[model samples]
Target chain A: EKASQLQTQRDSLSQKLQETELRNTELECQLLDLEQRLENRRLESESFRKSLRSLLELLDGKIFQLTELRDSLAKLMESDSS
Target chain B: EKASQLQTQRDSLSQKLQETELRNTELECQLLDLEQRLENRRLESESFRKSLRSLLELLDGKIFQLTELRDSLAKLMESDSS
Candidate 1:
């Protein structure tokens, strides 16, 4: 009867061990998936930053061109009066 | 002399015509530049819209992933007790 009890206890311990390993695997997979998603988000954010920078440059160029045109117009008007 | 006065008037008229042509050319150049800039701004705005769409998709995906994780965790806990 004691031997039977020991065998039953051993079986229960092995089953618990297997359950813990399976849980660990599931948690690891979840963690890996989360990491991949986070990396993708980071890359996307970086690309957005680059695009914003380009947009700012374009705006600055447009503003400069507008200012140049205004100055040229002013010069033409002055020449007309002279 | 009357001929001298006529000659002076002709020179003034020709000078005015040249000035008008030059002004027209300058205005045309400015208009073309403005149009090009406007086109560039439109294209940039479209690109920004696309980026915004992509960002929204990324946010939606992340939210979905988080919801899935929450559900999985809840299921895991429920199973553990059972």
Candidate 2:
């Protein structure tokens, strides 16, 4: 009777081991998927940063151009008034 | 003698064909590279547009806040004067 109980305990332990291994494999796969997603996000962020830099530069150029245009307009207005 | 001349002509034609093929391949590669660069530029432009939109919204909000603050200060000054 004790031998049967011991056998049953061993069977349960083996079943638990298999379940644990399966869970570990599932977790590992999930981890890899998450890592891949993170890598993609990093690349996307890098590209976004580069685009932002370019846009800022473009905006600065436009602002400078607008300021020059405004100054020219002001001068023209002053001359007209004079 | 005529056969020898024909053979020489054929060889020249074959060499020209190979050169043309190589040129075509090079042009194809350049075209692909340009297309990829254009795609990257387009994506960059899209992100830049989004960022600019957000920035404009933020600037508008701040401007509205500043206007409100100025109006409140003006009212306070008027009351003090009275």
Candidate 3:
């Protein structure tokens, strides 16, 4: 009877170990997928940053040109009045 | 001798089970942390998209104003020359 009990306990532990191993594999797969997604997102963010920087620079150039034009118009008006 | 062998097998399996269980717990913690980081990254990306949209709109407005100013300057120059 003691031997039988030991066998039963061993069976139960063996089953539990299998289940845990399967769960570990599943979790590992999920983690790998998540890591790849995060890497892709990081790359996308880097592109976004670069695009934003370019847009901001373009906007700055436009504003500078506008300011120059406005000053030229002001000077033109002053010369016309004189 | 057979029973002793069985007992030895059971002990080994039990030890393996414990190690697997610990590893599972560790993997679960890592998964939880990765999930939270992904969520946070998602929120940041959303904000970045919104900011990009706003910047584009601002750039559009500036271009329109620049065009108008350029036209005004051209008209003034033509009238002054005439």
Best by DockQ: 3
Q: All candidates' lDDT scores?
A: 0.65, 0.66, 0.89
Residue range A1-82, candidate 1, lDDT tens digits: 5555555555555565555556555655655565565566558768978987897798689779968977996898789953
Candidate 1 vs candidate 3: the lDDT winner is: 3
Measured against the true two-chain complex, the DockQ scores of the candidates, in the order shown, are: 0.00, 0.01, 0.74
What DockQ results for candidate 3? 0.74
lDDT of 3 at B13: 95
- For candidate 2 chain A, the 10 contiguous residues with the lowest summed lDDT are A2-11
Ranking by DockQ: 3, 2, 1
Candidate 3 C-alpha lDDT tens digits along A47-79: 978987897798689779968978996898789
B58-81 in candidate 3: lDDT tens per residue? 868977996897899689878995
Query: In candidate 2, what fraction of native interface contacts survive?
Result: 0.00
* Pairwise DockQ winner, candidates 2 and 3: 3
Q: State the iRMSD of every prediction, in order shown.
A: 48.5, 32.6, 0.8
Residue pairs of candidate 2 with colliding backbone atoms: none
**RMSD of candidate 2 to true structure, Å:** 24.0
User: What TM-score did chain B of candidate 1 earn?
Assistant: 0.80
Off by over 4 Å in 3: B61-82
